[model samples]
Target: MTVEIRVSRSPGERRVALLRDGVLAGYRVERPARPDGVGDTLRGRVVSRLPALAGGFVALPGGESGFLPESECEGRRLPPEGTILTLRVTRAAQSGKGLRISARVKQRPSGPLALLERGPDQALRWAAAHPAAPLVVDDPAELARLRAALGPRATGGAAFDDALESEADSLALPETPLPGGGRLIISPLPALTAVDVDSGGADPREANRQALPELTRQIVLRDLAGPILLDLAGLSLKARGALEPAIRSALVGDGLVQALGFGPLGLFEMKRARIHPPLHEVLADRPLARGLALLRLAAREAAAAPHRVLALSAPAPVLDAIRALPGALEEFAARAGRPLVLRDASLEEVSDA
Candidate 1:
């Protein structure tokens, strides 16, 4: 088996893609300045309690808050508002939702909040552990960091350009086309992610059989978590029986596979360990994409007025992201042979950018 790693460096974010036999197997985005606090432990105070939902809110030291389920209370009395407690993040915040925390702290944490290594680095170590699989990074600096982090297994000089950027974009697509004229529609609900399997005029069993491997790869690649409902088209008892084994075979060696069974109404139910939000929500939760869009616009506008001071305006979040990247704006301005000015404005001015 051949494994290839592609690392793409952009301002404020670094994206990693893993390929197995030329197929996209894994994808991750890391924003060093702003990390997803998946494994972080925070000292928090109970801010709200809801007995009906069996969950409540905990406010951390930095004014950030997370949802605390009753199960995370560990049989202790439900703390009233303003009660102090320690919590570990179960799932990072995403799509405007707060972090998911629990009372169970696996290790002693440091600071008011403690962070663990990002997912890409964790997966890089996993790849490096296999001696034969070569690791590649596009940036020399990134390659050096990985080598230091994972010994000599890391290597440099992989090609990454707009085509690879497009390939990375495809990983987060909602509708995934399958071989043999089938498709999988992945929908992220408030509770869990739902994947609808469509045979697309092909036999349901055959399509499902073909889709499982790719679907399994996507599950790991996208880092989708929590309960997953696979709605197989025209599922029968016999076909369902066949699929259980097939699904098991597909998921073999993939990390953190959980309960697998058919739920009410024959929906194939499965779960994956969720440490962080999936790629879609990760990108959505940050202003990196918006900052990139604004840079693209700056590129275009710079060409039109090479010597003029180009003014770029965006919301506070986007502006913060743009400025977070060292030398990015200055480099662009230098290339344009002009000065660039940044402004804070509503997204209306920056949406198309």
Candidate 2:
């Protein structure tokens, strides 16, 4: 039952891993391009109201707009266009949708369209939720910040446990091996996520039962939201019905998830509230991720071989992205004590040559 939170910070990205009994139970990534404004408070101007949709779009800071549902207005009528109001961000923008905002704040601050209060960092927010769990942070500045935010509970050390790091990295893969020779194939589609339970020649019911824990863990770790369709390996109606309680029990900790039971098409249906985008969506920009990865690799190489000059090669677009990111190349050169050579390679993979 022991739980710990580990945070690793790098230029342009922050990774947080939740470990339960030394196992990676949950993982989250925060990047500058994809900001998860879950708890930010802002003053926004209503742009338009659509009675048909029962919501309106509010112009937010930085040229972004959010949808404020009528239900989130605390029973107040939708304000006319051009009315300024204090708002809180309920969910981050995801899947081509803008942020979901609510107008139910304790105090309404009148002002121009701007960010009023920045939300807690993801690590601090997680620490608040699991107050008892000790926070292990790698970066000195982040550790100091966490200590100021939550005294005594934050400590300095390596954030990623070796085994847990490997496990967390593998989360990007589509296939997950289950106990008893079975595996789960998780595919995130545009409309809904689909999970197929492969029994691997074992008893269907037993395999499905064994996959429940890992399945739920993946759901939480990946932050998979929206409609999820599960296709259990060959099972009878009675067997599927019998597994309902177990499925519900497995999803006990996540309040956002609701088991909707089986559909007419024999697929098990569940819905998780859409907040932050899922892991796949967060890593959707492959070139950007690759560029960041190359920078990290260069850093590691410099540490391992202090005297070896490093040259990073990648696609032209990837190199352009790296050069354009503020402080990205500068930080690497500062840490490595030598400028890195950048080369344009037509290959898809990034490498330190």
Candidate 3:
């Protein structure tokens, strides 16, 4: 199978499209440099606890508030609201929340189980299936060991084949030639992805209002081939048209496609292929925790015009690159009439603040 990968840049973000047999198999959008999220270990103070919810709120060191669900509140002592608690970001932002885990002790399985650690997805071990397996409370490691020692003998019933068939059968895209399209946003969850689409100008005045974004999103999903998520938050109901096709697409193969009317804000909603962050977006903006104040500057001269001066400002790397361009300095001098000015700072310093 030949795979052709193409990377293209747009005004605000970069796009990556993978084509197999002339079909668009995968697409990724990288935003203009940002920060990484999740995976950070933090020590937070319990702001409050809810016995009913079996959870508490934590004031993270940097002033971020997190929820520690009761399922994870295993310690004997229920730390008072102000008690300092340690935790880590397990899953990315989901349903307006971040998944977390406490640093307290946990559990695991103990040997040969260790050797079969990779096949849990294939196991049929339900609570009732393996009631005798010792819950060797310790850490994540021990949990894996115990599971393997006595986990179902990898007896992948029809369920396993069904899941594999679903994954393999869906996500099949088309070879339609699309214009320069770009998708840029934060990395979605690893298992499911939601996609939202906005048309350039689908106006009803011209009679081209083909369901506005709802239709646009559907077109994108079919064109892109893969999972589709439409997160329309402010669209009108009548404009949604019928959602049967989109819904049908979504339900296929474990819902590779999901469509809905406007969201809370009236926008379309759907799901798409669950891929990791696109290469470019991952390289530039991984942990999106803060902002960047880096600066770049450039001076340019015009050949001849009413206004023959130009001055540019941006970040340090951009400034350095601009200055290195041939005739860049002279052009800047002539165009700006006044020398271009620049202030440089480390990318980290600019964003960390």
Candidate 4:
């Protein structure tokens, strides 16, 4: 299968879409202000150990702390309180949980709490993982940075296709239409994500069968990890058991996913490794996301009417969030080659004049 990676850049976020045979297969979003520290190596001081929890907290740089599990210590003893240890971030902080770190004592170095090594950004990591796939980016600066980092491997131009962007944007929606008039309603909760399979008058078994592939695709594209409960449309206990193979087959390539069969409540249970914040969580801050979206709109308007002075009007909170982003408005104005007028108004009121 032909695979390609496309990157889209805005002032507030960078979105990466992985396409297989011209179909959107995977999607990832990265924000400039909040990075998911999944592979960072840091020198941290052990805070305390709890035998009951089988883990201890380690104070990281920048006043953040991560939990170091005993299992991740390579069967070695946990470091004592206040002892400095080399640690690698295994998972990002998400859902009210701190980061998950593991001891990398073999590369131990004496130093104050600080970042020892920065992890490769998501796009570069994706490129390294899929060497055969061509990495195409939209922004020239991003392309140059990738070229500097990957050298000859970064052989692609600014080609973030509009159709691909549209497809990726649709992934942000909670409802996904499936074949044969069926649809999947995905909702992410604090405990576990729930996927309701609505047959939409289609045959139950067929709808359930057709929903598997798209369901898995949505799961991966949304980066939905941890516990997932699927309520199949009108599937019996025996029928669900019979369809186990199909469910497992749908989630084949992703090593992090595990199919745990059907639960007592008739919900199919699955678990995925939590590495980074899910897409919903990444965009959870509604005001911030809306503010960035407004900026994107302002950029388009500015491009369309270069001579007109663009004025953005929105709620105070949204405007405040936009202003809080360092150089966001300035970058937009610089790219637009004009200053933008900001106006505060009601939440429902938004306009670019």
| Per-residue alpha-carbon lDDT of candidate 3 for residues 1-353, written as tens digits (9 for 90 to 100) | 54443333222233334444544444443332321234455556677787876777766644456677766555544567666555555433333344354535323322111111111210112223334322221123323543465563222211112332232223232211112232222223444444443333343222223333333433433332223344432335555444435444434533344444445544455554322332322333322211111111121023233254433434566656544434434434443455445444565466778
Best by lDDT: 2
- After superposing candidate 4 on the true structure, give the runs of residues whose Cα lies further than 4 Å from its correct spot: 105-108, 152-159, 304-307, 347-353
Where is model 3 poorest over a 10-residue stretch in terms of lDDT? 288-297
Q: What is the per-residue lDDT of model 4 for residues 1-353, given as tens digits with 9 covering 90 to 100?
A: 89887876666677887888988887888876667888888999989998888889999999999999888886656778998888999999987788999995466768899998888778888888888877887666677888897776565554556787577678778999999999999999998999999999999999999999999989999999899999999878988788888888998878889989888888889999999899999888877788888887787788778899888888888889888877777778777888788888764353433
Ten contiguous residues minimizing lDDT sum, candidate 1: 109-118
TM-scores, one per candidate: 0.70, 0.92, 0.33, 0.93
lDDT of 2 at 165: 71
lDDT ranking, high to low? 2, 4, 1, 3
Q: Which residue segments of model 1 deviate by more than 4 Å?
A: 41-59, 66-90, 95-97, 100-134, 159-164, 235-238, 285-290, 293-353
1-353 in candidate 1: lDDT tens per residue? 78776765543456777777876667787765566776666677788998887989887756688889988886745678877776777778864577888886543433444233333444464476555666777556567788776776667764455666676777768888899899988998768989988999998888998889878877887788888888887778667866787777777767787748876578888888767678777666457677865776676577677666778877888888787767667656555777568878875556558
- Model 1 per-residue lDDT at 245: 74
Q: Backbone clashes in each candidate structure, one number apiece?
A: 0, 0, 56, 0
lDDT of 3: 0.38
Better of 2 and 3 by TM-score: 2
